[model samples]
Target: MGSLVYREELEEDKNSAFTWEVQANNKAYNRQFKQKAFLCWWRKKYKRNAIHTAKYNVFSFLPLNLYEQFHRMSNLYFLLIIVLQGIPEISTLPWFTLFAPLVCLLTIRATRDLVDDIGRHRSDRAINNRPCQILVGKSFLWRKWKNLCVGDLVCLHKDSIVPADLVLLASTEPSSLCYVETADIDGETNLKFRQAPTITHHELTNIRKMASFQGKVVCEEPNSRMHHFVGCLEWEGKKYPLDSGNILLRGCRIRNTDTCYGMVIYAGFDTKIMKNCGKIHLKRTKLDHLMNRLVVLVSFPKSLLWLRFNPWPGIFLMLQMWPKKSY
Candidate 1:
């Protein structure tokens, strides 16, 4: 059996006329209403996360500030001991009374430091709530629509993250518009020029026309095998025909222009693009966490050791001074 070709299918179905009025009206309405609602939802989420972060920041400072003040006072008390040590006659009277204030200062400082540590823990929780998913290793990925089918071409536009890998059927002149950044796929710092009518077998086999692949990361590794397959992508059970000059910007990909499309070879979690991106990010996050823990472990013991040894001389001198008897 001959493999089904998209252009052949469309040519065979010549009786089906393409209607622009309904699609245009629907797209306009969606762009206005649906997109507005999505933006509002995003704003609300950002505000909520900000509030949580603010609360955490406020609480985190309490311990550090309180203990800092206490530590200052302790230093002052230590200074007083040195001053008292200078006058031999004053040391004869019940000099132990002078040590009381220093002891109190040290105690307060220690307690405040403990409280600050607790506050820091709370702050960390708040920070974690904010989306800090930095794309590491190579790229980041997300599934666009779950219900997409074989030979379906889709359109996507600006500020959209790509849902799947696709071929470039049509795109604006790269020099005329801003350069496209594909750091997630390309793993490079510079933006790449987007030339039209480029073909990659993985995503746009059905889209034979000139188009741009928007919203997906450009794969960086030259040696890695790109997965090419035709399957159903989940989206409200409606199958949109993959056509020429149509834009497909589902999931994280966005189309800058209205008149572009590419065949959907894969969608959802199974897309090779998403899986690779996710794996890169996961490994990066784990490494970051491990480094943080290692830093804490290395520094903490050294700090404790410093505190133990340095403070002893002054404390020893205070203990040795003989108290004068009252006449």
Candidate 2:
């Protein structure tokens, strides 16, 4: 037991020493929406809670779809054939023959992608518009999840999903302890416990006291370390150390405790869960690889035929089409 105690003390000392040289980042508080004009600007200071899972929007659909489609060598080959057909001097077939089919193919794919992305847009809207209670002045008012900002206090009820990363404060439970379920975050069904800072748990007992309390939290920058946190809450000229046990991460569900109050530390894209959300990437199937190889094989022979039969005429016509030198 003595040896274990000494080892724990040594580890704590080393951690303290390593962090002692780090500078503090104090978060700004904005309780009232009176600064309404700057609200957008303030939210921008921290990442907005709005999520965009869709790949394309109205303005980008055409160009982006075309770009993705042309990534296939077959599409490029068809396009080259269409261009060749357009040149009357070298044309062996009507351009519309290739043009119509290529248009249909691109249109079908684009329509499919557009339909899928519309569903994503609807999902994003539904989630961003979900209502939560945010502290404004001394009272809590219902607001959308996307409207939440860093340093804002939130009141959560049992079974409610946490909208952002927050530091647990006073709760209805004894000793200000809060119970939460992280099934949405880590696929765990068991309840986890989060405790409020002793100073805050005791002093901020009521809504009025909570509104009056002006505390600054200094912590590490937003990160994906879900089970790790390092910070200190400064209030009334004293700082209380905080850790993961003192936090209620986004996507967690409040359980057992009837009500709990927490201050948002990370919102929207800055939350640990959001940090872990990897970007959506395009996945090509084995069929796509085989088709590309076949297209290359077919195109090589066509190119050789064109060069052997009509290369000189095509080159001469292209040169004639080019603008004469100014000289």
Candidate 3:
């Protein structure tokens, strides 16, 4: 049994193989868009370009919402009361009375959460479906943001939104410089310029050259470092150093450059902005916590009343039935 378990563990380890290094347009590791995942066991699996921020969906709404709502002390207390009311000996009221109110309260809260999450879903859809020009072969063609993959070459025009984190390759501006506005990313309206390496700027000057370009980038894993980037671009048997100034981040807006080309380094949630967005968690305000405490406090007296009144008749009968003792 131990040997079998070890063999299974080794198999699992082999299936989870992934790396931080990304190779541009290399079919050996960079799986093409629209390809299935099951066929790519030996290759590294990268994150998709689609992002989901919604907390619940059609299949998960009821169960997930109930699970989240019951995390509150008040809801659990109410549920306890409803369960107690189901017992004829302990209950002073019908179970349905408390059950109905709980159902209503849960419905109201769930509806509110559902509406908010629906808005998030719509926003995600809009962003993911936004159009951009991607290099299909030797020519660029329009595609949705979600269609982008790591190692894909992309073209950005002036006033365009960047779909993913990309390395600046070449641009129409002198010296392959590209300007961008990071208003959506940092809330700063200041324009920042990124430049391509001297080798790429001179060599990959046209669409045909960019299509045939194959460069491997060795870099650190995705992180929330917005102003820092460190990597090296390897191409044509030479390596060029890269930094933050050579990279264009997702959520940046192209500005003051007519045409610029880039190769995607990070897509989807791996992008720095999305990494900084972080995961959504259940947050309760002070007032919410106070309300929960208040519910418990308010219900305590009712429980005390039940304890005081319940079985009192039996106690009186027992008192009357006690045997008289000679004093």
Model 1 poorest 10 in a row by lDDT: 44-53
lDDT score of residue 236 within candidate 2: 73
Q: List model 3 lDDT by residue over 21-97, tens digit each.
A: 67877655765333255765453457869999998888988998999999888889989988878866557999998
Assess candidate 3 and give its lDDT.
0.87
lDDT comparison, 2 vs 3, better candidate: 3
Q: What's each prediction's TM-score?
A: 0.25, 0.81, 0.82
Estimate every model's Cα lDDT from 0 to 1.
Answer: 0.38, 0.82, 0.87
Best by TM-score: 3
Off by over 4 Å in 2: 1-44, 297-327
TM-score of 1: 0.25
lDDT of 1: 0.38
**Lowest summed-lDDT stretch of 10 residues in model 3?**
11-20
Cα RMSD to the true fold for all candidates? 18.0, 6.6, 9.9
Write down the RMSD of candidate 3 (Cα, Å).
9.9
- Which scores better on lDDT, 1 or 2? 2
